[model samples]
Target: MPERSSGRRPAALVIGGGMTGMLAAAVLSDHADVTVVESDVLPRLPAPRKGLPQARHAHLLWSGGVRALENLLPGITDRLVTRGARRVPIMSGMVSKAPSGQWFRRFDDARHLNLVCSRDLLDSTIRTEVLRLPRVTLRERTELIALEGDADRVTGVRVRGSVGDGVLSAALVIDATGRASRAPVWLTDLGLPPVEERVVDAGVGYASRFYRAPASTGEDFPIVNVQADPRRPPGRGGIILPVEEGRWLVTLSGTRGGRPSRDNGEFVPFARSLAHPVIGDLLAGAEPISDVVTTHSTANKRRYFEKSPRWPAGFAVLGDAVAGYNPVYGHGLTAAAQSVLALKRVLAGHALDSPETARHIQRRAARPVGQAWDLAVGQDVLYPGATDETPGRLERVAAGFIDRAVDAGARNPHALRVLLDVMSMERPPARLLAPDMLFRVFLGRKEPLLDGPPLTEAERKAAGL
Candidate 1:
């Protein structure tokens, strides 16, 4: 272990070393000397760590998130691109099928863009940039066991490390641990009321594999997606995303009974069975690069930490700790990035040691969390047996509106722009409900609906399909 400096500045403790945790540490560094602790030793290279199994699956960072990352760690996107990540322009570089069963046109003009890469690469890149700050120190192979303060204010963290058990006192404590976060229990242990919580479990599952890009496709291929229709039973979907190293990461997913299997032989066949066969067609000639990996932890869960009437002053929760979105929406990274931006906003005006500061920060952090939660469950709840919670009139209305927007987006670039703005998180969810967007939806698709995947001759020739 490297010797860390103990400065005279105020100190903060951030639990977790994943992207969100690192982002929290980066932001907290502006106000205090930050100490980041994790149970697993973070990898030095762009490789998977035990704590993040989802790294093996396809991950996309939307423009909304990319912008937030730029604000958090300047030049991060450039660093990632330089390290082999692809900056894919929104609809222009994508071939997609909406839940309405219409294939989207590959519009050349796009209003937003996203970064696609292995989750490992994305985390490692940000990790490198964040750890370089003199005010932030990394303590790998350490676990946060509990909070160190009372119900009124959190003063630090108690942890178990390489040598023995210990305590790290700080002016503020942050929990960035993902879906497995124990903050709720930790709060309960502090004599605070349990945070209100809900889980809209779609019973979503993922099965992902990697392949060498087909020789004919060369180096560039549009991202191919087949979205599941919640309106139909057995919601199933798949996406073929181009990552670094001439690789395409194909992830197949389904709700409940429709789930994909981890058996390697079953992978492509499942892809073949989606709403459309584009993912299957693209994978037909591709060379396999890795075995199938599956995860069943893709539920939309939220801990209403902000709603707690008694939030401790020295504490706040961020990232997957507050809300975990289904990965198919690809909003996890984006939401996490924005949550940190939210944290940065709160920290800018508040003192680190103030309990009021922590409470204010928690509420602001929950804003993005709530946005992402609504976005995910809106569709997820429509899946058969996804949740016991009944969808009310508002849910039906929102779903219907989104359905029309999807219909419009398939052909109308204007409608697509509005949808993309919301999808990118560059704009609020209401962007989809704006008068202009509603007019576009009412106007309907500009071009005739596509009968099949709109693959260009060059793309077909390259794909050898």
Candidate 2:
């Protein structure tokens, strides 16, 4: 953390006060005076707001992301857990149906875990903590109207507030504005060529609702997941994750024509219609607490800003502004957290006012984006009418290996360990190609695949199944 100067501190303008923006502020505050401008008036407590419609859905911080976030904000995980968020262990505390139509057994050994809670709580917790930093200022109900500088160097941002519009000059400007980011138009306005942008929309739609859990399904309840089989036309999936307040956040999803609806009547049927009927069965006995809320913008979109031949000195983009994944993958927050770490590392030794520094940060931040993008679009592109462009030779080969790996995971603990590693973002996809993992995938002795959901007798009784 290199302070810009002791006499006059360098300033930064961060657009969007969501999770990504908050993390960016936390990291930037270590190097400069940071200001976060948000269009919506943020709630003081852990409650939902107008800007984040997706907050209605469930959100989790995988172990890898939790580690990255912990590095940036110490005691953040304990803070979340103390506030009622559950740290659910992977595999051991999960009952999941793989796309290969095999129910993965709940192994006794757990390696990875994730924090499960409402997006509201996750955002609010980070917001409260990040804004308290000495040099961080939060501006509410402010709209970013335009970029302050030209194509070669970004000096600040022109924002419109309730009183009037004004330009806030800064040495660095971050666009953490999320999916609604207009960075492309903003850059083009500054005379820079548009960056390469790609969208791999599975045409996936999300339908989520909250439910009060059965009394017997106490604090230690397992997460129930029914994954969509991409091999099947119009893929569908659902999950039952226990969040704070002893309730479950159930989100059902479908691809293209098979999307789930907000109609209360169709909720359970969609869950029942998944590869496994377990989610629907569990929901049948649970009490509903919220109406079904639906969102259709679950596309995997990415802007390759780093590839641009010319990048401005004072401008950088992070989080959903750079790349956004399907919520079902649960990698958006994790990727953003990792991006913040990348930014912090880049700023450690580089001058804040250097264009090369901004370029380095942009390129490094996109590393996690590439990882999550490949993982998400690899499956999303397989959905019917997902995209017009076909997957390249490498993609097809990777997909082949993934299918075999999934089949291996269902029956083999060694294979399952590798799968969980990649799924939890602890390891890269190349880990599956390691010699030992390849040996297990090809020659390891396999246990019999499960014919149905692998729930214990006590677990079934608790859910009143």
Candidate 3:
């Protein structure tokens, strides 16, 4: 192990420089001088980098995530919009066909909103804001080698950077290295027990490409989505996200035998093969601007660190390090942001050197992680071969009720708001079971379901449909 100095400021060591890691650094900056160590030097502008392959795909920031960002860095929403990100109102700013085979009516509601932009743009925007903090220092090309302390506490970390191997001592250490985090292995080396983990994989794969937006599309162009039914085998789906710079980021996905292809020629065809052809039809008049990028590691995996009885102090995990959700649900960023917020809350009252401080942060962080994990895996586990263990009776009952809720929400704006409240992570999933929501779901009046994609005449003309 590399030798570490004993005397240092009350600093925090963040192990990644991605969005979540940056957010963690931003929060920790107020407590202590923070060091963000990254294996890959992040880009200074809104462009893709080697570390984040998913940056090429469509990423949505739900209202929950939007609020988290604003709370962490005030006026960030405006900064992103000034740089071309769109603050799209939920339901109204979307054209979606639910897995239940009903087209969601574009209800005139603004309570729920989503931030739409390329992942690169989102990352760069957040990174820029976080790095502006005087107390936060970013160490490029630095990689974590191991945790420095034992099972009782973590004093710092052994790391290898551009210069050589050494130790960065801190009062706290946060692992935010995404899905590839080595914390589990490092923990065991410290004589701590293995963390409980579960994985629900639907074998879903994705292929995404960018398109020059059709000339006539307005700035508020709706996001077009056709969702896959988990009850059906070889599920297929597609989405068209109107991102910054007048570009459309289109992503097509499928489970197991139906996965999309990386071939650029097959991108549009795959979109056409989804449950509905609206995504394909809209793309017909648009010109491709980038080749398709594909990924196969879409799985909902959770590490229950909070449940570990032997959890150590002075070390904590956040972001995908704690739980990596299926990107299809678009909850990863939101969950991570909320986890950082929880960390902020925990640190507000507790001293960094206090016993069980890391444990408290870890437990609070798990709250958002559990919410996101359930949402991402609820439908995934229903797919055959998604998991070894069968979903319990409660899960089955919940699924049935969710299907009914989706059906009702398609026809009733009130029910739709209730569903969006949960889906957007603005409220707990229990919100769906509230008395009023139950009445709306089971007995309230519902409008006639639209027979096709609810594209406005103006939207159709703009897409040349």
Candidate 4:
């Protein structure tokens, strides 16, 4: 650990100003003065930033993440809801067709809820909440040049701001940069071994657009999703999220050959071509609010920073820098929130200046990251050209059982409860393999599966179906 001036409070540098970075700053503010460095000038309102290209797509914050956010910034959820974000109950608030091709019953479960809103709103709210802390500051339009330390310990970060280049010395440096982080190169530049990494890309692509919600749908309109079936090559899916201001943030996605196109004329057709046409049918009567935005950066990439034998003492990485998953699973946001909570927990037990603190934080962050990784790749690996390495026997076995679980969940409320728990990231995937859960999957009584989406009469009428 590097020493500051005698009796001077230690300073922390957070590189990135997105959700994960904001949460990290909030937590670190308790122990040190924190400076958040961001390349883009952040918006005061719930508007998009250039750094977050995925903001145009729908984003879900699972109950696990909701709890984490509340823990980090108390009353933030209320603030979000007041600003038009929704707290939607999991199964009850969603009308979804599983990847295995079964429509889930809208079983009510208060325990599993998701925060639904535009990514811009969520980020803006969190950024506002974090910045209000007395000890935290934000440096916008600043570029991170390099880390200023040796392989053993990180002293601070070198940055080039509008004012010109300068070094910001700190006792701790946390990296919260997303999928495009340069941390791996930064680490290697400081004389460490290359971090082990794995990328499972189904060659997924996304095309998203906004639409005005139908007049007949009320404030509690449910999320409608049609998930892709990995067993089918070039799997296609779509979701209609009723976000704030009575608008729908609709996103359509597909693997490799089946990806959606950017042509405005093709957007609705693409949704109609999904495993189900419910999204398209609903959008047929709505008015477009935004042009179609497409992105192809939907790969599940993970860097094994925790496994590196020689981690620097004063530096740690969080969020998508640790792992970025396919957007369809909706676990990236949850995993990042949980990882920040892990950082909070580890910091409670370790001294900030200790050499082992960064290593400990890095390892703790990996637990949540790994959990989300397994869930995403469990299906992604089944795609034909996702990765060169074939699914191991264990992965295959897990997938078979998961398929059985999903089948049971679609028809049985009890099974669905357990499934939602795991899917929402409230519990580890191991919960699905419990003896009782296995019994429920194999022999539990179930309602007959529906032949089509179980849309309520009012919902069907609302879409003029």
Candidate 5:
């Protein structure tokens, strides 16, 4: 980490104190004085706030994101687990219905594992860690009105406070305001044109609710997922996640006209209609704790800020603000963590005051955005009424390869490990195209696909199934 000269602390101003913003603040705090300006008063515990409606749904911190979080805040995972977040081994702790069919046996190689918890708990834990940094300060109830610089350089930001307009100058300004960000307008105000944009809207809607688990099964229950078959007529999926507080956060999602309903009465029926009814059956005996909460903004949207000819100095955008992917893919937080890591790497080697540093960071951060964009858009484009343009030949080939690899993963442990690595964000998708992986895919599923969830007799009795 670099230090400021003249005994003055270098400052970085962050807009939106959500997970991405807080993670960025933590990374920046090592070398700079940081202040996070948030519009809503953040909660001290694992409670939802007005700003994050998506928190009502189930959120899985993929292994890659978990590693990044641990790197940013050591001992944080232990804290979360201590508080009841479940560490689910990739195939061992998951009962999944894949596009190919039901996944077969779990391999002993379990390096890839996802962290299952509510978005509220995940964000609150990270926020608490970030706020504990002495160099970091948080300004709740403060909103950013506009940028305070020209197209060539960004020196600071103008914020709206109870008193009036206030200016906070800093070497860097990070925008993490999420899917509804106004970074385009802010840049245009600085005499720059709108950044090139891309959208693959599947029009997916989500309906989620929390339920207290059956006492016999308790908090250690495995994650149950019934994924939508995109090749099917209507795209629908359901997930039962064992989150913090010994509860299951179940979400049912559908695309376009097949969207789930907010009617609490229809929730169970919708889950029951999924390709697999395990999630529905499990929910039958549990106690509902929250009403059905629904959201419809599950499109994959990206801004090509890094491609701009003249990116300003001392400014960068991250998280959903840069590229908001479909929540059904569960790539948002992992992408944000990867972006923060890129920022840390860029800042460590370059002078923050340098005019080219922000551009460099933005360019590096775009790598993850591009990868996630490709992954989300590839699947989303298959849905009805998803987009106007068809996938290009190369994209079609890529999707074909992925589909085959997923089919191979249904039985081959080696192929399954490779696929799970990519899905967990620990490895790039290119890993699946490696010679060894390609051989497995060529050979196809090594064993017969399981007829149902691989539950032991004891587990079945415990769930009263």
Candidate 6:
């Protein structure tokens, strides 16, 4: 490892204090002094911050992400559960309506699960863990103005205080400022060419609200989802996630003309009108806790910085800054966690000042980003008015294979395990393309497809339906 000047600890400056930035700071703190700069005042508790409006919506920490986060911050999952996040076992703990039909009976042997909770709680828990590191300091109410070095290398960032224009410098800089980052322009100011970018907008919109869980069910309710079928002409979906505080976070979404409404009165009816009305039925018995919140920023965007021939040393981008996916896929947080894990791996074997550390880290992180981007954009492109990026022959073949796998999985336990593994991010998508999986796909649905939500009589009575 290259030693810092006079054997002193190197310093790293992180722009943005969101989950990704906080995780980055935590990982970097082990090897250097880290400071996190945030443009908004962070809430001391698991509450909403000004910058993350999406916090009002539901978010899931898939099992793969949970494992990565635990690796980064041990015992964080237990802490999150203690605070209200539910550990929902995959397939078994979910009631899903798929395009092929209802999901089959999930076996107990499933290895993955999803962490269901509000985005605020998830971010706050991560923020708390990162701040507990003694070597990490936070400078809230500060914004990055520009990079402090040239095209060959970035020495630091020029940040203006939220109250004033005071600036600070460090040895390395990380841009985790999210989808709205200005790093491309900052690099251009240093005479670098524009970074390559790709955008696949689905014209997707979201409307969500909080509802107090039904008294009969208490706390520990399973997540219910009515998924959209992209094979259909129009795309629409809904999900009801059991969150902390004995509440359910319900989100309804649509693409193009099928968009859900922001009107509170229309929420239930809109949900009922979805391909499956289970979500609407479940919400009928719950008490509303919040008004409908709506947003329309579900674009799958990627900035190809690693492919840029001349990336500056001592600088890197992570999380939404590198790629922002369609939120409907619920891959944003997981992708961020995966990126942070990649950063830690790269730093463990290389020095921050090494000639190729940043480039190598970016390349490794790109793997997860590419996986998520492909999944999101591939489906989004099929929706009418979603994008003009025509699906090539390869994309169509992949989609057909996935569709077959999903149909098979809905009835075959072996096939379900493969689908669950990929959905949880525990394994790569290629796992579904394995020879065994392909054979299962050929066999197709072994049992009759379910016609509706497979709810037990007890659950039906509890929901007052």
The Cα local distance difference test for each model comes to: 0.88, 0.89, 0.91, 0.92, 0.85, 0.85
lDDT of 5 by residue, 17-105 (tens): 99999989998887789999999999999898999999998788888988987887889999988877878787788878876466556
Best by lDDT: 4
Pairs with steric clashes in candidate 2? none
lDDT per residue (tens digit) for residues 17-72 in model 1 = 99999999999998889999999999999998899998999899999999999999
Q: When superposed on Cα atoms, how far off is each prediction in RMSD?
A: 3.5, 1.5, 3.3, 1.9, 1.7, 1.7
lDDT of 6: 0.85
When summed lDDT is taken over every stretch of 10 residues in candidate 1, the lowest stretch is 1-10
Query: 230-312, model 6: which lDDT tens digit per residue?
Result: 77746789998888888889999988888888899999999998987889888999999899999998888999988898888
Task: Kindly report which residue stretches of model 4 are placed more than 4 angstroms away from their true locations once superposed.
Answer: 1-6
Candidate 3 structure quality by residue, lDDT tens digits, 1-465? 222224555889999999999999999998789999999979999998999999998899999989988898889999999999999998799999999899999889888879999999999999999999999999999888899989999999998889899999988999999999989999999999998999999999999999999989979889999999998879999899999999999989999999998998888888889888999999999999999999998999999999998977889999999999889999999999999999998888787766678999999999989999989899999988999988889999999999999999999999999898888888999999999989988899989989999999999999999
Name every residue pair that clashes in candidate 6: none
- Greater TM-score among 4 and 5 belongs to 4
Candidate 1's C-alpha runs over 4 A off are 1-8
Q: Which 10 consecutive positions of candidate 4 have the poorest summed lDDT?
A: 1-10
Q: Each candidate's TM vs. the true structure? A: 0.97, 0.97, 0.98, 0.98, 0.97, 0.96
Instruction: Tell me the TM-score of model 6.
Output: 0.96
Model 4's lDDT to the true fold?
Answer: 0.92
